[model samples]
Target: MNRWFMTLLASLGLLLIVSGCSTKKDEAPKDPKAAAYDFSNEKSFVVYGEGIAPVHTVSPAQAIVLAKRAAITDGYRQLGEKLYGVKINSSETVKDAMIRDSRITAQVNALIKDAAITDATFKDGLYSIRMEITMSARRWHELFSY
Candidate 1:
């Protein structure tokens, strides 16, 4: 009995030591290509847009087609908005200082090139599209006016 107890205690001690040493060391994350890029300005980003199916479509296929077209246009608009910005115009006509009428309008105008539709889906009368665009340093500078 004495010898068995000593062997069991030894086995438990070895297990504890192995488990304690297996803990991860405190170290910074390892980046394989940390110093590869000196000046990287090329990037790609994605945008998403959704459109509701029109009520007056001639057929189900036509509904999906129209919704997909609208979704694609919306995606381009969103991408333009992200790259540039939305222009807003607001007016308030206060007749006799009584706040009679107010109106607000927003618009975005941009020419997007080479934007690819990455994914598109139509479900439950709603169509959505994911568009991606890649901009190199030259394109970036041109758009940013730098």
Candidate 2:
């Protein structure tokens, strides 16, 4: 019927217009607040330090201090620390420990803008350096929501 053909033609024309309009792509807003770092292959570190310092802002200086502090906390307290078999008063080389600590910290800084660290002093003969990925609370929470 003529009416049926007209109806079909009109529907096809409408669909074509709608499809053409959708071809225009939307762009993302530009803002540093929207800036982000991908941490899929991000390095991580586990350290043994005294305590975490509350820094107002994060920087390389803060990272270094935090790394060193984490490398030598809790001389002999937790059962985990005692299990390492490292003698607390023994003559192990502090220089060696510092070197290992630095290596681990470097890896951590490579991951997050604001590093998260925990202190663990184990009793192992050689000073232990553990690495873990850190995320700031703001960044961490923001990542998921976005």
Highest lDDT scorer: 1
TM-score, one value per model: 0.69, 0.21
Tens digits of lDDT, candidate 2, 26-128: 5443665554443333333343434344345387567545644555333222222322233333232357446323212111111123333343333422233
Q: In candidate 1, which residue pairs clash?
A: none
lDDT per prediction?
A: 0.85, 0.43
Q: How displaced is residue 1 in candidate 2, in Å?
A: 1.2
Model 2 misplaced regions, further than 4 Å: 27-67, 71-146
Whole-model lDDT, model 2: 0.43
> What overall lDDT, based on C-alpha atoms, would model 1 receive against the true structure?
0.85
Residue 34 error, candidate 2, Å: 20
* Residue-wise C-alpha lDDT for candidate 1, range 1-146, written one tens digit per residue: 99999999999999999999987766533664442332256768799989889999789989898898899989999998998789999999988869889999999988889999988888999999999999775667556853
